[model samples]
Target: MKHRFSRMGVRGRLLLAVLATVAVALIVMTVAFNYLLSVSFRSDADDRLRNLALDESSRISISNGRVTLPQPTGEIQEFGTQIWVFVSGATVSSPNVEPNLQAAAKSLDGQPAQYLDVPEQEVRLYGVPLYYEEERIGTIVSGLWMGSYNYNLRMTLLATGALALVLLLVLGFVGRWVLNAAFRPVSRMTAEAEAWSIADLDRRFEMGEPHDEVTQLASTLDGMLDRLAAGLRRERRFSAEVSHQLRTPLAKIKAEAELALRRERNPAYYQEALASVSQSADQMTRTVEALMAAAQEEGSLARGRASVWQVLEEASASVGVLAGENGVRVRVEPPLRSLYIGVERDIALQIIQPVVENACRFARSTVILGAGRNGKEVVFTVEDDGAGVTEEEKDRIFEPGVRGSAAEAAEAGGATSRGAGLGLSLARRLARAASGDVEVTAGRIGARFVVRLPTG
Candidate 1:
């Protein structure tokens, strides 16, 4: 089965993308908000400076092209050197002159009305020529230092940046926690699967109530587990059936062979009878070996590193004699790469033999032994061009000693069949032991047995 644990999948990727987008947007908006706040504060300061200049400009009077100031108000006095200047053509009087104002004054002399912004001091200086009776006498200049405004702006930006950084960090932590919580079910499923073993095949994953994708996945896994448990039960019953069906014949052969030997009458008859007994014993031994291999497969103890394609080739080689006897040819499909995983060779060989033998028995022309993958699972298929099984018998074919009408008829007609109806049952049992399964395909053309195994 292909699970979500090894992959980040859609949900995790989407969560990460959303978090990144939110963080970027929050930072951009925070910076813009701080910048706008600084501009608003600066605008208010400029408005105050403009009003102060208007109020103080009227206090100064011009006489003989000279500027003079009356006693300034207490409110104006508090401003100290941070003052306003009134200048005429040859007279200039001020409560203040900045160390850098000499250049500013000369620059404003030729201009009747203008505003200049100085980069060095972060100030906006306005020089307006004052007039009485439409005759311009001198100019009035005002200085607005932007130091406090700049300081406030810088602080605001720094504070907003810090807050944004903190919030992003907090959000990252919260996101990680939320993601972990959201994936709790998946994590639980992983832990449970990891702890699960073949000895406790009946156990199943507990599903949650969310009924989302995770729940759906759990439900699917549960269904698979149910099938596996049921298959195991069927295999157990099949094993018992094989034992019952084969024991009586073996006992009869043993008794008859022993009696013929004891009588020691007709040397030729005795020799023939002894050979027949040996044949029976050999057949019985092979059957027992097959059964033992099947059991090992069912126990999942047959797992070792083996190539699937090589196994199929070996099975084909083993079935060659039987295929010839039944007038059947084995065809191996191309592009079968030798991929190896953990699986016992004996178990794999035993599982494939009976399937191939049965295919030869029913096949009219050819049997193809092939292997492929269905997603992450390895699939081995034995397909024959013969009379396909009927729908009614398809489900019962893998039950030990439960032969279908055609197979039974072949047995009754003295065809010297090798099977006592336990072949497929044994095959399925062994396949399951390797964490794999066997199933009859749904097609109507021929008999097909497919074995599915996990790659990991």
Candidate 2:
């Protein structure tokens, strides 16, 4: 499967990837640049040391199997300076005694001449083994301080460090700017996508460049939105037409039934006609209710301040007669403290009544209505002693028309599922309208539905 970044948001992942790339590049650059700078400085230092040793080559003498050096006193020492010269033979007395010259003389290793730089003082030492026609005489040693070359290397390193810091800062800012600019089209597309709603789906996303990926995405989304908007329009138009068309026939049927009942001599005929008329009226009422719920769901709620307790009381009172008829008792456990919040009264009432009535319909004996504080929100739970929904059905239980296959086996007695199968669907929409949600509780023994509403 392709890699899916399901955890982090798109913007976060993009920024993280960009920053990581920049960080890796910066580290590699710093290391490589530092190494190159160090090598260059070291090469200059070595060259200066060698040149100093070669320039002083003539200032050497040997006599009596011993080496000597010219005395250059009172010389002002520059930075990184060091001087060392020692005797090559056992004799120490000489015309000009070289400091630490014996150390360089011992480093010959069978060579005629050799040069070494002293680490402590940055000084160079040259050892020349004196030879006359393959006969060993003695060695002449000379030393020169290299303070200037050490200072050069130090200054170069300091400059390199400062330049590297400035470059990193400039590159960091530039990289961020370029990245944001490069992704501007994507950002705009996302914002516009978020703003699109069912009411405004006819509006299309403005494409920047047709060949670009972002533009292609915008074109595809616009086409999809067009199809969806057309489908919704067709659905709404059909629903309204059906409702309008059925109204006249339903009115005629009800009126004729009432007229016949008034004129009928037989009491049985009157009762049967009235029952048929009442059933038709109930079906008409249910159809209208479904349409109303669908229309309301199409638009966002006009929120206002209202009391949670008051809405709950109203819903309970409305469903009280239904619950009693089904032999289900409902007891509301009012909150101990006065609880209030902002919400639409009608929507809230619509949401709760259906849930309570449905619970009562299937309730074997008792239906409990309970409300309490849930942190910053208020929660209501409607539970019944009926056969609770199974785990599989729980997912689609809120879906319209979905019910327990055993719904016929329940206490509802052969009555069809309530109100166009919109009890749960409408309830959920209304709950969301109030910045709330409805959830079906999963358990082994009972039917339970929980509703959550924000306190503000």
Candidate 3:
């Protein structure tokens, strides 16, 4: 039974529940109506019988403890009531009393004043003892035929049952209609959401501010779709960035391998070729790891704490060779107070190294790295005393494959920029992956880049 109920559709189940509730209420009402009707009929019969007995007794007179019967004034009938009198071995009754009814009335002799049912004769009898000066006298019994009352009660019961059944049927139909009307929008929304999920993730319900359950549901589904669309965009961007960044190293490795295999060479020459291939392979590996790490969503990234100073020092040291080769001085300034960031040491270092490398590559004399706290974030500032980034290129330089005008000019003049224009993009991606950001800001005399991470 439980499984069968569970197998029903929601609409069917709701309809059944409503019908069951109405059925129970109808049953209670029908039973109560019939009971009250029966009581009303019985109460009328009892009142008639009682009134008849009392009136007949009042007309009688007693003399010296002997009962005196009153003359029959009229056809002593009211609501088909009958009366019987017994005194000193004599019996007197209303006109046309049947033998069975007389016998049924006699059975009430010497009994207290109360009502009794004589089902065989369809009569209800009530007995009252006549009294004079507290002396024993006689008894009066009144009976009322129950046939009409029983018939009316039966008719009322039938009518009530038929009406209740009709009401239940009507309510069942109305309840089904109401449930369908209520669930119609839900069904349509579910189907549309399923279709949109498969074919058009960008589609949204776009319902206005929520004022009801259905509208609230639409709002929630819209939010979910937005997140799914965002994740898909991120995946596509990650793929494109990886391919663009890894292509050069992969081609270099392939060229070296092909050249080394073309001819037999001295050990040193072959060793040099293998070493170049190895270096390219290493570069490819780093490129892949950095892209993979940056591609992760912040919620899925492994969380750890890293000292702000430690990560800054490590990022600066990693680009020491580039700074020395470029004749640039790299300086790390300690924070006013020790601070921590919410990302792991390695990931934090990865996030800052690219910006530092960019600074070292473009600096003329000095590159400064410093850390400070801002609200609930740890901010690192990297400044380089070189041709400052133009306002137009500051944001554009972070796009993959976009090079600043200075870097482009230096490359055209045969001066190495030592970058393929992916460093800043990777830096920004990794920082965002850790729930942080990297952005360029206006500097007093050079280019300034700000990296912000949540404080640990």
Candidate 4:
């Protein structure tokens, strides 16, 4: 039974559980009612037979050891309604009386009232001892037949059981139907999910205004699909961007190799060709690494605590040569508490160096790198004295391949577009990967890039 129940689906199990409860209730009620009915029947029979015996005994008289027996009444002549047998030693009231009744009367051992089973029938009876001046003369016993009452009880029980079973069966099916109706939304959700493919993620289970469990589940599934669709889009965009960025260096390398292979070249020519190829190869490698770092939406800097001030010092030192060559003075501010954030030292440098390099390339004089603790976060700022970004371009500064008007103007002046506009974008990505982020805030001077990471 346990295995059978376990094999059934949820609907089947629920239906069977309800039916089983109904069956138990019906059985209990039937048994209790039958017991009460039987008790009532026995009580009625006892009362009737007890009264009849006393009345009939009064009709007979006995004096001086000679008994005067009255003729049995017309009511007593009816066989099953009443029966009487006078007890005097071994003599019964009538010779032709039922032997079962005679036997029952003879063996009366003086109980107030009880049932006695005859050979072919059952009877409820009472024994009354006749008395003359407190001296026992004989015993008069009376009984009523229980065959008709028992027959009626059997018919009643059969009908009651049949009706109960019919009602339970009807209700069980109806309950299953009701449960199916209640779970219709879930059924629709399953069907929709089965029909969907990865390309169809935009289609949502738009169950209107979630007011119930089924609708709420549909809403949750829709939300999950939304996230999945967004992730897929990001992945596709990353691939396209990486391919576009790698093409330039690959073409450069191919052109250099073809020029070198066009004719027999001197050793110096071969050396320059190899050197050109190597530079292009390095450029391609850098481009790949930058794209990869930028595409990493979830950074791996969620562990390892390091001092923010120390990270700032290392980042400034790494880019110190570029700062000097670009004529941009770099300033590093010592934080008040040596605040620590959840990232490694190199990752911290990776996030900071790009923004600082971008700063130095376009800076008029000096770029300031500052760090401090803000609540549970470590906030770092890189502010430059270059031509600051216009309000209209502030939002576009960190977009991939989107150069700010000031950076474009700087490039127009032959100050090289250091790192192809991806540096700041990649900086933000790498910062975000560490459970941190960089944003362009309004700066009175040049663009102010603020980086915030969670304090460990």
How does each model score on lDDT? 0.69, 0.63, 0.79, 0.74
Tens-digit per-residue lDDT, 281-339, candidate 4: 77567656655655663556566778888878766755555676678899998887758
Off by over 4 Å in 1: 1-23, 57-91, 109-122, 129-138, 227-244, 256-456
Q: Which stretches of model 4 miss by more than 4 angstroms?
A: 1-7, 57-70, 73-79, 85-87, 90-97, 109-114, 203-241, 261-265, 291-456
Per TM-score, what order, best first? 3, 4, 1, 2
> RMSD per prediction, one decimal?
16.2, 19.1, 8.4, 8.8
How far residue 367's Cα lies from its native spot in candidate 4, in Å, is 23
lDDT (Cα, 0-100) at 170 in candidate 4: 96
Best candidate per TM-score, number? 3
lDDT, residue 33, model 2 = 73
Which candidate number has the best lDDT? 3
Give per-model TM-scores. Answer: 0.50, 0.46, 0.65, 0.61
TM-score attained by model 2? 0.46
lDDT comparing candidate 2 with the true structure: 0.63
The candidate with the higher TM-score, 2 or 4, is: 4
List pairs with backbone clashes in candidate 3: none
- Model 1 per-residue lDDT at 46: 64
Give per-residue CA lDDT, model 3, range 152-219, as digits (tens): 88898899889989998998888888888888878888887667645475788877899888789889
The TM-score measured for candidate 1 stands at 0.50
